[model samples]
Target chain A: MLKATIDAEIFREAIEAISALVPECRLHTAEDGITTRAVDTANVAMIAFTLKKEAFDTFKATKSEIGVDISKMKNIFNMGGKGDLISLELADNAQKMAVSVHGYHYSITLLDTNTIRKDPNSPTINLPGKVVISGEDLNNAIKAAAVISDKIAMGINPKDQTFYMVAEGDTDHIQREFGKDELKSLSPVEARSLFSLDYLRDMGKVMSKATEVEVCLGIDHPVRFSFDIAGGNGHVEYLLAPRIEAD
Target chain B: MLKATIDAEIFREAIEAISALVPECRLHTAEDGITTRAVDTANVAMIAFTLKKEAFDTFKATKSEIGVDISKMKNIFNMGGKGDLISLELADNAQKMAVSVHGYHYSITLLDTNTIRKDPNSPTINLPGKVVISGEDLNNAIKAAAVISDKIAMGINPKDQTFYMVAEGDTDHIQREFGKDELKSLSPVEARSLFSLDYLRDMGKVMSKATEVEVCLGIDHPVRFSFDIAGGNGHVEYLLAPRIEAD
Candidate 1:
């Protein structure tokens, strides 16, 4: 059993983060908060999200697991205005959840948790390079690179003390570099990886609203993006596998 | 020979007006200004436009009839920034039109005048009922009606002293009424005609920017919309045939 009320904008941000990589997730609700961890069908991206009870205006819950259709939730919330307050209620062992927002009430059938894949184990890896930068700057660079190629190469130049994104198209290339002055912080150990713009584009749109995003990378390894939401009451992480760079 | 420079925004409005009904037009350039009149292929709608020399920053031209690809011109101008100035040049008897905006230069091949349809003669018709309204308000009603049905009936109620638009969908309906208080002026004549929403949606987008639009109507007759652009230096008129209204 669970009941909670959250700001529409913050809820939208949380759902968007999960929907970016997967269409659905098995959400675990507990007394302290709620969490979801899932990987994309292609196994190319993984997302783990946590929203503390403190993030909601009012919260009460018992340890329970429920399946959530992330994509469908996104569509329903779209009808809500920015200043709206969204309320959700679920009874113990119920197959449907009640949602109310902006005077409209809807009953959404929850997917059976038994049908959902078991939560994936968080992979362990050592990423030596890290940089913290404004989300707007990171999103802007992703958009610029997308215009030039289907994939983008993001890396840290230890000697130059900078983070750069480069896209090379047929007979054309685009690059954006950010020095220490532009980044909040940087661990400038040599790191470079090529990633498909398709994945980054979706993730970038959600992260764009974040004030600061910590990007972790290693040589030809998966890139990890971490950010806080709900004014620090929530956290999200996105891990995207690298694409092979063919010279 | 023609050489002129105009604000990108003003040029965009002009192109959008022409492109609304037809993709190409035989543009008539003279010492005074430029003009074009074209009817859609189905001959259900007609557009006549004129831009005066005073509207441009610099203007110089001789009597010439050139075929302009309206849709293409719209695409080219999309590259220009809001504050950018668009410069156009065409040498006497040249086949190419040089367009420069924001330091980028492009040479567009002018269409053969003989390949384009002759300018349609403006038809003479008497539309007694008339109303003058703010473009934003008029366009808003059109948009609202589009969601309800494929056709809209606009009319003036002499007894009520109001102008109104009504759309009846299969299972839904929408109506917006503007009494004398909401409209700038009204003729208050009993006039009503059904029109396809497809055409109005495009025309409404262009007219939405105009300060005021003059609408002339008649029972079971065509609707005529007139508005000024380029700060009164230019004028545009749209005439659309009424669609058959069935009970």
Candidate 2:
């Protein structure tokens, strides 16, 4: 059993963050919050999202797991007005979830968890390089890179104490460097990785709304992006596997 | 020889109006202004556009005809900022038209006039039923109708002095009525015609920017939409052949 009322904007942000990586997810709900961890079909990217009870205007739930169609949720949320309160309710063992927003009632059938892939265990890896920057800056670099190439390389220069993104094209390239003055913080350890622009573009759009995002990296390792949402009451993390650099 | 300087927005509007009907057109240039009349490949619709000298900041030309690719022009204009001035220059007998906007110079090779379809002569048909309404209102009705069906029926109710648009779907229908209070003017002649939504949707988008759009209709006849652009110095008329209404 679960019942919750959340601001439409916050709910939209949360759902969009997950939908950027996966079409559906098994969401775990408890008295304190809800969380989901899922990987894209290609297994090239993973997204983990958590929304605390504090993010909601009203919240009540028993520990439970339910399958959610993130894409459908996105469509329903698209119809809602900003700042509107969206109420969600599900009876114990029910297969359909009820969502009401702006006088419109949506009854969505929950996907069967048995048909979904079991949640993967969070992998442990050592990523020494880290940087915190405004989400707009990160997204801007992603967009600029996309204009020139289908892949982007992100790295940290320890000596320069700067983070940089580069996309090389057939005859030209685009590069953007964020120095200490431009970033909120940086722990510059030498690290570099190449990533596919296809995934980054979607992730960038969702991350752009965040005020600040923490990016973690390592040599030839997957990149991790962490950001706060719902005024810091909710959190989202994206882990994208690196693409082999073709010299 | 032709040389003209016009506001980017006015040029964009003219190009968009022409592009809605045909991909390329034989544009006629005179000392006084420029004009184009072209029918879509399917010959189901035709567009006539005229831009008077008053619409341009400066205008000079001889009697000439040149084929223009409307889609290419749209791309070049997309780079311009609002209120920017776009200049066009064509030397006598030159194959390329020079366009300069925002300090960028582009030489576009003109299509051969012989390769383009000859301008269609405006058909003579009496459309007695007339209604002058806000462009936005007319466009809104077109959009609403499109949501339900691929064709719309427009008619004027003589006794009630109302112009109505109706679209029927498999199981439902949507109708919008514009009474005298909602229209700039109305000529209540008993008239009704069915038209394909595909053509109206594109035309509606362009007409939506006009303050007023004059719609002329007749039973079993084509519909004619007339509107002013470029601050009334320019005029555009769209004539769409009606689709047979299967009982």
Candidate 3:
């Protein structure tokens, strides 16, 4: 059994973060909070999100796992106005969830977990390069790179003490660098990786709303983005594998 | 020879009005103003637009005909910001037009007039039923009808002195009525016609910005929508042929 009431904006932010990588997820709910860890179908990206009890106006639940359709949740949230409160309730062993927002009630049938991929274990790796920057600045770099190329390379310049993003087109290229003065903080460890713009474009949109995001990088390794939501009560992390660079 | 400088917003509005119906047009320029009349490729809808000299900050032109690619003009206008001044210059008998906006200069090759459709003559038909209403309201009705059916019926009830729009779906229907209070004015002549929503949906979007739109109707005849642009200095009329109602 679970019952929760959350600010509409906060709930939308959480659902949008998860929907960026996967259409469905197996959400685990407990007395303390709710969490989900899922990988995209292509295995190139994974998203892990946690919303603590503090994120909600009221929360109560027993330890349980339920299948959620992230896309359906996005649709329902689209009907809500800013500052609206959303209430959700699910009875023990029930197949349907009740959602109420803005005077509208919706009964959504939960997807069967048996048909979804099992949650994958988070990989263990060390990324020596770390940088904390404003989410708007990071998203701006992603958008600028997308205008010129389908792939972007991100790395740290230890000598310059700056984080740099570069996208090379057949005849044109764009490069942007963020120095210590521009970033909240930076660890200038040598790191470089190429990533597909398709994934970053969608991820950038969701990250744009965040105040600050921590980006971790390593040579030819996955890139990880971590940020806080719901005024620090919730957390979201995105891990995206690098694309092999072509000679 | 022609030289003109106009507000970017006014220019964008004119281009958008023409682009909604046709990709290319034979534009007529005179000392008084500029005008264009053309039908869509499908020949089901026609657009006639006029922008008076009063709409421009500076205007000088003689009687001339120029073929314009509406799509290309739209792309150039995309670079302009609100209230920006745009300048256009063309030499007599020249096939290229120079357009400058926001410090950027673009030389566009004009389409050959011989390749474009000849100006269509405005049909001589009396539409006894007329109603003047807010453009936003009209656009809203068109959008609401599109949700239920591919066609919508618009008519005036002489007895009730009301204008009504209706769309009937296989399982449902929607009706919206505008009375004297809601409309600026009404002729209250009994008239009804079924029109394809495809054309109206596109035209409605452009019309929505106008403060007032005049809708003229007739039984089994085409519908004509007239509105002012450029703060009353310019005018646009859209005539859409009716679709035969299936029994």
Candidate 4:
């Protein structure tokens, strides 16, 4: 059983982050808050998301795993206006959840968890190099590189103490290097990995609103992005696998 | 010879109005300003547009006809930042037109006049019923109707002194009626005609910015939408052929 009232904007922000990586998820609800860990079908990306109870205006829940259709949540919120108070209620052992926002009532049938893959375990990896930068700057670099190639390489240049993102096209390449002056903070360590722009582009939009995002990198390994949302009451992490660079 | 400088925004508004109907246009430039009239490939709709000299920051020109690729202009302008003054130059009988906005210089090859359709003659028809309403309201009605069906009927009822727009779908219909309180002014003349919503939706976007739009209608005849752009220095008219309303 679960009942909660949350600001529509904050709810939208949370749902958008989950929807970016998967169409559906197994949401774990507890007295403290809700959390979800899921990987893309192709196993190219993974998202670990949490919305703490403090982020909601009122919250109550028992330990339970709820199957949520992320796309359906998007459609439901689209009908709501800004600043609306969204109320969500689920009875014990019920297959349907009741949602009300701005005079509209919607009964959404929960997805069958048996059909969705079990929640993935967050992998443990060592990434020594790290940099914190404004989300806008990170998204801008991703957009600029996408204009030249479908793959982007991000790394920390130890010698210059800079973070750089570069994309190589068949005949041309674009690069953006963030020096100490532009970065919020940086650990001058060696790191470089190539990633597909398709996944980064989707994740970039969600991160663009964050004030600061910590990007962790490793040599020839997956990259991780960590950021806070809902005024720091909620948190999100994105882990993207590196692509093989063909010579 | 022709050389002129205009605000990027005003120029975009005028081109967008024309491009909604045709992709290419034979632009006629004179000392007074520029004018273009073209019909869509299917000839189901027509656009009559004019941009006076007063709308430009600097203007000078001799009588000439220039072929303009509307879609190409869209691409060029996409590179220019807002508030940038666009400079257009064409030497006497030159095949290339120089367009400079911001720090970029683009030389566009003019399409062959012979390859484009000749100027379409404007048909003279009497449309007695008229209503003047805010462009926002007009566009809103068009959008609301589009959700119901592909065809919309616009009319002025003599008995109620009201303007009505209605659309009928397979099993549902939506109707919006503007009384004296809602419309700026309405002519109490019996007029009704059905038009394809595809054309209206494109035209609606351009009209949404105008302060006021004048709508003229006739019995089983075409509907005419007239509005001003560039702060009254320019004008645009869209005449869409009526579609048969099947039972």
Candidate 5:
């Protein structure tokens, strides 16, 4: 078993930034240490990794150690990177587990040690409205609206065959329009949703790594996206809460 | 004059990533409301940016409309994407300049626009050491050292005829060694220097954009590097201060 603690900001900065540039990462664990697996097919590619036992001492003060799923740990550790070394410990029977990064430790006591559910069932979401569009275009549209407003209000009117992302502030207001079929597949049921620009921007981290994303929309409902990732093994789903309209 | 208030992050993220990817942007001032420029060719590419006066309300807000050097603005806008919409204003006399990004508006009073140096000055240090290696290797080395320490200390001794990069923390330390005459030239004069890992990492940004780089090392002095960038006018010179260490 292996356990370690590291600078949370350093971990996030490296994982988030680099993961955005590549696909899924394979984490390797052994009796002596832990290793990360990533390949750069691109000519300009490189990966630097290192981990020590002392680094994990902060988190695993008394507990001996545990192996970790770098992928899940990466997401769980995204809370602004300010914590002592993350700690990991495996149960004596080696059938269950616990992991923590930057003081945000979570106990997954129910997980089966031998089976890592690659496609765990993500929360089932039935969005009232939907659309299909280029990730690039959608990313750009979000960026444009985000310039002036902290949150973007997206509305799709199937009858009108239009999709809109709007943001308004006291001194600035922006409305970006993308044709119904410009880059997305849209359903007629009209729906509107609002989400923080910050979260959406963070979402951009995964856009390029994954080719296509499906966005589910509803009035004041949380936005859900299903990523058709390159790898056939893992199932990752993201859900974001929407900001309620004052009116 | 073009002025607009864009989201600090949206603008910064796109510009920073793109600039790091491309070298020497060709900024064309639209004579009749159209301008185009091409940067880096293969990995990362950017095309014409079309913003009509209607789209650019700030253009409608001012009378001074002139094309300015984008490269300069790109350099000064180094605080990262937090600098929201950048303000491009032509001086009343058309010589000075002003830039507002990320809430910080800087007024750059130029001594002489024509005399101001646009090119990075090449230092004449008669560098005692030279190395030709994979940009990836160097980037990785710096990254590893950066993890433990703020600055990387490098030692070059003729007696040992070796090059070393070391990072030492209170309890953590790392060392990377390169063979003598790693590249093209190696002189007898022994020298050692320490420089900020952050700045070196910034220079490393060009690594992915270029294949091979020539590194020049001086004793207790600034380090210089030149990259044979691909695509457009690809060249950059980065100078960094040496960290003093008392033995």
Candidate 6:
């Protein structure tokens, strides 16, 4: 038996959005494991999820710790019957997890919850430069690029006081500019990066709830965007692999 | 110069959603004398699309018109550029439309606009019964069924006060019952029908923004769902052919 308290709607929405793109079902037992992978037919994307084990209750050691189908589990979670608290009970001899959300209860059996190995080769570059901007601005930028190109090139030049996104295709091109006034603050440096449009779109889908987004970037490096929600304790950090374009 | 104002966003959204599904590029003009098409994929998905009369937008006043690529037109319309008011001006001696949305202006050359005739057939027969419901509820029910089955059976019985959605597949089966409590009202008789889940999903997508929806039904007959949005001034209706069940 397990019980946890969380910002119900946000958590459910985030999980639902991520599960739509992720295909695998691997739940890490560690509280700080952070990133998880759920793969599907089209492409595999990483979901960086953070939940303090303290958010849960009734501490008891269980012999069996398992992963559940992320998609189905997310669907059941989103049905939301319990309210602020979510309760999970695993039948003693069965593979099903009795999940209760708000007041509604659903019993969903596990469809194979094997643990997925982490991508060790994934870059761990420390990003020092950051900027804060409106979520709407960034969301629109990503969405616009999504139409013309599959990769978005982001450039921030503090000295020049400009932020730009350029999406170029063989036939059409789109460029958007955001000035220094729109930025919360800028760390001085000329840094640019690129990332896949699909991942950016996925991140934008969930992060649309945030009014302000903190974006950290470095040239030829992974980009991290953090969304502060649920009074700051609840946070979602998205790390996207940069696409290096040859000059 | 070309400019048009559509009063409601719901209409634009519905038209975009429906048009995205159909591959045909050209549409008959309001007078049916001129046929027009936009070459942008995004604009095709959006309403209030405008293009300069060019080799592409050229339609047969008494001659055959060019056929434009639909996919591209849909993109520009979806960009939702600043303007609720749209204006389009032709570039003299050039095959380009200077499009304006709000203050945002962009010049786009036409690819090819073909005047194609559309054969739209509305379902015949007066449905014997009707049900009124919130579009949100219906969309959710169909979405749930879509996850489990490709085809769903919808049965309405006013006599017994029941509306049922049943979907059966090799591995999964779902039957959802919406009684009088869930529905605003139901006028029923001896009427039941089956339809493709794809079509239902599309219909639901088209009516996603609607607050209240009216569903007209008849046994073994086409189903019609009408959305009354923004105080009934806005109307969107979808008629779908029925799938006769073996039993």
Query: DockQ of each model against the real complex?
Result: 0.04, 0.04, 0.03, 0.04, 0.02, 0.10
Listed for every candidate in order, the interface RMSD values in angstroms are 9.0, 9.3, 9.3, 8.5, 13.9, 3.3
Give the TM-score (vs. native) of candidate 3: 0.55
Q: Which stretches of candidate 5 lie over 4 Å from their true place?
A: A1-14, A17-124, A171-173, A205-211, A228-236, B1-148, B151-162, B169-174, B180-247
Per-residue lDDT of candidate 6, residues A1-247 (tens digit): 3333444665576466456456445444343322344434433344455544443443232344455566666655665543466555654445676666667777877655445443324447788777888887888788877777799888787777777777775555566767788787777667788888978887787677788888888898878787765445445666666877964
Residues B1-247, candidate 4: write the lDDT tens digits. Answer: 7899999998888888888888999999999999999999999999999999999999999999988889867644644457989898999999878776653345667888889999999999899999998999989999998988899999999899999999999999999999999888888999999999999999999899988999999999999999999999999999999999789
Model 1 residue B18 lDDT score = 88
What is the per-residue lDDT of model 3 for residues B101-172, given as tens digits with 9 covering 90 to 100? 888898999999999988888899899999999998898788766765799999999999999987776533
lDDT of 2 by residue, B133-245 (tens): 99988887787667557999999999999998877765335567788899999997999999999999999999999999999999989999999999999999999999999
Candidate 6, residues B77-149, lDDT tens digits: the string is 5656432654434433335545444333445555444344333333256987788888888888899999988
Docking level of model 5? incorrect
Name the better of 4 and 5 by DockQ.
Answer: 4
TM-score of each: 0.56, 0.55, 0.55, 0.55, 0.40, 0.52
Residue B244 lDDT in candidate 2: 96
Candidate 1 Cα RMSD after full superposition onto the native fold (Å): 8.6
Quote the positional error of residue A47 for candidate 6 in Å: 3.5
**Ten consecutive residues with minimal summed lDDT in candidate 5 chain B?**
B43-52
| Residue range A62-164, candidate 4, lDDT tens digits | 9999899999898768656788999999998889999988888989999988899998887999999999999988987777666557999999999999998
- Compared to the true structure, candidate 1 yields what TM-score? 0.56
Q: Is candidate 3 or candidate 5 better by DockQ?
A: 3
With a 3 Å backbone cut-off (N, CA, C), the pairs that clash in candidate 2 are: none
For model 6 chain A, give the 10-residue run with minimal summed lDDT: A28-37
Query: Between prediction 1 and prediction 5, which has the larger DockQ?
Result: 1
| Model 5 TM-score on a 0 to 1 scale | 0.40
Regions of model 6 farther than 4 Å from truth? A5-7, A17-21, A29-45, A53-65, A81-84, A90-96, A102-104, A107-115, A119-122, A244-247, B1-71, B79-107, B112-247
